[model samples]
Target: MEPPAPGAGPDRPGPHDGDPGAGRIWLARAALLGGVLVPLVAAGLRGVLWVLLGVAGLALTGAGLWWTLAHTGAVRACGAALAVAAPLTVLGLYATHGMLGPAVASLALVLLAVAAAGRVLSPRSRAGGAAPAPATAPRHPWILMNPHSGGGKVGRFHLVERARAAGARVTVLTGRQDVTALARRAVAEGADLLAVAGGDGTQALVAEVAHENDLPFVVIPAGTRNHFALDLGLDREDPAAALEALTDGVERRVDLGFAGDRVFVNNASFGTYAAVVGNPGYRGAQLRTALHDLPELLTGERTPRLRMRSGHRRAQGLQAVLVSNNPYRYAVGPGRGHRGSLDSGLLGVLCVHVDNTVQAARTAGGRKGGLTRLTGTEVTVDADAATVPVGIDGEHVMLPVPVVCRIVPGALRVRVPRGRGAPRGSRPSADWHRVLHLARRSGPVWHHRPHTTGG
Candidate 1:
């Protein structure tokens, strides 16, 4: 076939690449507005108050511009500007007036700028803390919407259209597209905020892309069970709400987990749960089946061999291993024990060692008496098979036995709703839940805590 026509490499498109320069003019204009002019105006005659206000105003304006440019899919220069502006601004202030207060004030202003940028740029906040000024100007927020997430609510909810209308400048990815690749491309193309509309696993995939570049991510819950989203206090039922939050919501920093080289925004589990979830037939199973089958997973008899190491301790034959960046344990009702926070910088490991149904029941009951046990951080797991399928944030991957997992402290920013339980202190929610259940089996409704960390 004539060597498949010269220069026709399968991966390479022949001489007909689409024009990327088409939007350069608009990008240039937007840069002039959001990046330079806004900061200049905001920085007018900087006194302390003016400086602070200018910092905030300029930061917000810059964030808006960054998002706008991102929506239009423009080139990145804003991020570079962000990287330098705060320090330069501080330096200039110090050089102009050498005094402790001025110097400190300048530094604070710089921090404020960083925080603002970080907030807008962060995916989710630990507790909606302000954004940090990026090490570089932030690339725009790249949003990937799953129209099918939340029952095909993408268009019905008017998120993409409204985001575009609201000057968000969105790019909608088709289901057939490689999500991970798309996220990487967006980052390379200058995205600081990588937003996704999907389930927990989808969020994890997008998070993988964001983490690779140290970019912040925004999670829009558009999937069933939305455990991660609900945990983050994102409104999964409404796409419009999520879109608004994506642009206007508060930004905060949270933690993530690193298992091998892969990054996870939530918990990673294996054993019976993994097998169940991995099975294509699992989703079709009835609730009765779930009740009947789930218990058997912890028995170790039904589940295959599993070996694990946690810091100094090593454990084997674990029926299930759940390593959560932030413990997801929560009380079933009010006045219950502490729930884990998303930003606690700790990993929660739950391993099942029970070999019988009675023992499994105690573990499931969250009582300290069962074969189900809880421990903290830095764990490794291995299997007899050279490659054991692993579940990360509910997504499965094949890896050699003895998978190592560790907490990557302060790696993500998550948004969590303020809860009412902790007017006093934060304790592990499982313990508290157990206490509350003992007091009254009926239990109170679980309340959201003010802190970002969960039990």
Candidate 2:
């Protein structure tokens, strides 16, 4: 309804203009320091018992995670129970000892700290290689809108009417024909731009076609999760806003990750998530299916395992492997956990392998633990089994073993509106050093301004 502003929403302001947001940066620093001290102060008050209880809970949680990801049957159930009970047990201990206030306060401070970290760490702008201004608008643009994707975001946003109103032809997908074929038909019919108002699965298909035809591809973000759109800094909440790119836009060359020859806008998932998502019930009964399947699939009789080879380094007995188009920075909630650049020109690989609780504990603090992350031009995933279940862009599929993944740098021409907001996860990974330095430079309390989350 309103004018287009990518990544902007009711809570997130649109087009920052000239604001550097210095005041909020200092507040974020204060929150982070307070987040740490509150817990320490609480522990100091509770003394040895508090320290022991926290360690015990973390250990229990670690053990539960180990078993949940690698055990089955009764053992698996107990592991799940331990995992669930660990945090609750700590809370209970706090409540029984009259330390409930401290516990809740510490937790709230920690949550605030994380949110502040996200706000501070997230990049205010794309680092470099800003998209070039487009020379001309498309003479004919065709968008395929999935009527059901993202729980009917296309219809809910009235994307059809909006896109058509923008002078672009719209086709609502009704499972009537192959989506890739339909796009090809549109391109062959002299459509100069290719766009999709659907999920990442559909985005991949249309994106590949656009790449092959040397046409600019626009993502409408009318899909569930829309990881690609989020990583690209598009407006997820307003799918219609992306249509602004059709008229006023810039062209940026972005890379696409490929498993074998299949293209993916996001990452190719294997092991735990892949196995669970491959189940048919995932669509109709997601939570139930995940709860039922995760434990068994993780450590069942014939648990699926993978071996990841990123360049020469190899990690074996991996419970899961995520091969992404580009590396993802520190992620928990908000601001981080997505790729910073689509044109990083490397495959981001994450390998997980924790056989027991000890390994899990070590992993919680040490780098040599079971988890491994690295980037390479090419990475290969192999399993002893002839085939592996893979979740490519969240679309379940069974692929032959030794699924090789690689990044084709700047392989696609992506069009986004010029005045887009900061893409999600663009400034992932907080630098504590930066925070400290910023605090010293922020001047005194008198000079400090009210905190603001700039658009």
Candidate 3:
């Protein structure tokens, strides 16, 4: 039997397909209430609950500090302080309270029990299923790898040797040559399958060539933030595992976003992000560059005034605009960071037209007070200047005014190893509705239905 598309599956009923019925909603609410209350009641009964809370808070805070340090790299002073203070504070709390140890011990046991319960009650976890190897897999594949990306991930992971073992000719990109030219040459030399181990910028260049030649493309997520890889359900943490696709992979078609002639696998942005990325210093000091440039871009008298039109809606003097391949659910929690389906033939448009810097900061912080968002098949952006700067998948470029962004549905064919699991922290959570359905002993609350092009 033929395997389904990478993520597509049999059609099934969903909440939006039909009304979930009034009774189901009410029952869901009850279950949600119980889930919350039960935890609180248990904590209240234990006198040492305060100690457990303190430990958990410290651990979470420390984690946040580490993440900030890793991403920004300029927060050494604050990170150092937090690193020293957190442990000492925890130690002081433990010394002052004798019962704290017993409380923590009990909490650990409770957590274990809860985790086990969740594992048993949750729906079965699906394995990464295998896809039939593409015919092109037999040919000697050419892989363009960016060693500098993800802090020299290729060298650190010894990816060249692994690719050679998988019957691939690997090319490590140094500063001397152009990536797109090299990719075109490889295709001309009869490369059947093309792959890249780099960030989205390099991925886009290679993908564009592959798409034009009708070659199956493989993505190895070896970048600081592999947004496209995450959306494709590729394992971002394990770049080596991506090679498994060469032997056992399935082909799936996905949409690609275009800004004029340039293609972007992720999203493109104009305004604040574009201006900031254009700065040469952004690569070394992203936080510092953003802090210094944002004010000038937002408040300066020379700030470019942008006008955008999509369908009947028109926006003017926007401080920033982000157009993604598909709409992202900002209301959802962290788990919703990646797109669930890439075959959606629509562009996700977000326009920021703030009155002042404060409003801009609020909007950047994810508050949607002055934000205008919409989805369309195509969007047009015009600016007062003859040319405009754009950040396409984090790479800055200049384009003539009246930038047209559109979605090319199913334009790129991607291959991934069968049964490859979703990226870490990207799986959707079991919300209240799912709990209600499960309580009623019905079928799977969330079904993996095949995504169609039309809305």
- How do the residues 1-455 of candidate 1 rate in per-residue lDDT, one tens digit apiece? 33442343553323233322212222323332343333334444544443454344345444433332222223234543553464466556645654335445544443333333222212232133343322322236677887776667676777787766644546675757787888778778877677787767778888877666776676666676666665565565764666554444555566778777767777778676776676565566744444445534543245576877665566677666777776555443553322245665667777656554334334433344323334455678787777666678777676666678887777765432233111111221224333332223221112223222222
TM-score of each: 0.58, 0.78, 0.68
Q: Model 2: per-residue lDDT, tens digit, 1-455? A: 76745544553444443224434555666766665566567666445567567767877788787777566678778888988998899889888877777656765655555455445445433233453656478999999999899999988999999998999999888765798899999999999999999999999989999988989999999988888898888889998889889988878888989998888888999888888888889999998788778656655645567887765688788888998877666644465567756776877777887666788866653234777777788888999899898888998888998999988989998888877734454353543433455556533221222121100
Instruction: Write the candidate numbers in order of decreasing TM-score.
Output: 2, 3, 1
Q: What's the lDDT for candidate 1?
A: 0.54
Q: Name the regions of candidate 2 deviating beyond 4 angstroms.
A: 1-52, 65-77, 95-132, 301-304, 334-336, 357-368, 425-455
TM-score of 3: 0.68
Q: Which candidate is the best by TM-score?
A: 2
In candidate 3, residue 211 scores what lDDT?
89
Angstrom error of the Cα, residue 240, model 1: value is 2.0
Give residue 118's lDDT in candidate 2 (0 to 100). Answer: 47
Stretches of candidate 3 off by over 4 Å are 1-136, 331-336, 357-367, 421-426, 429-455
Error of 1 at 364 (Å): 6.4
Error of 2 at 8 (Å): 36
Q: What is each predicted model's overall lDDT from 0 to 1? A: 0.54, 0.75, 0.69
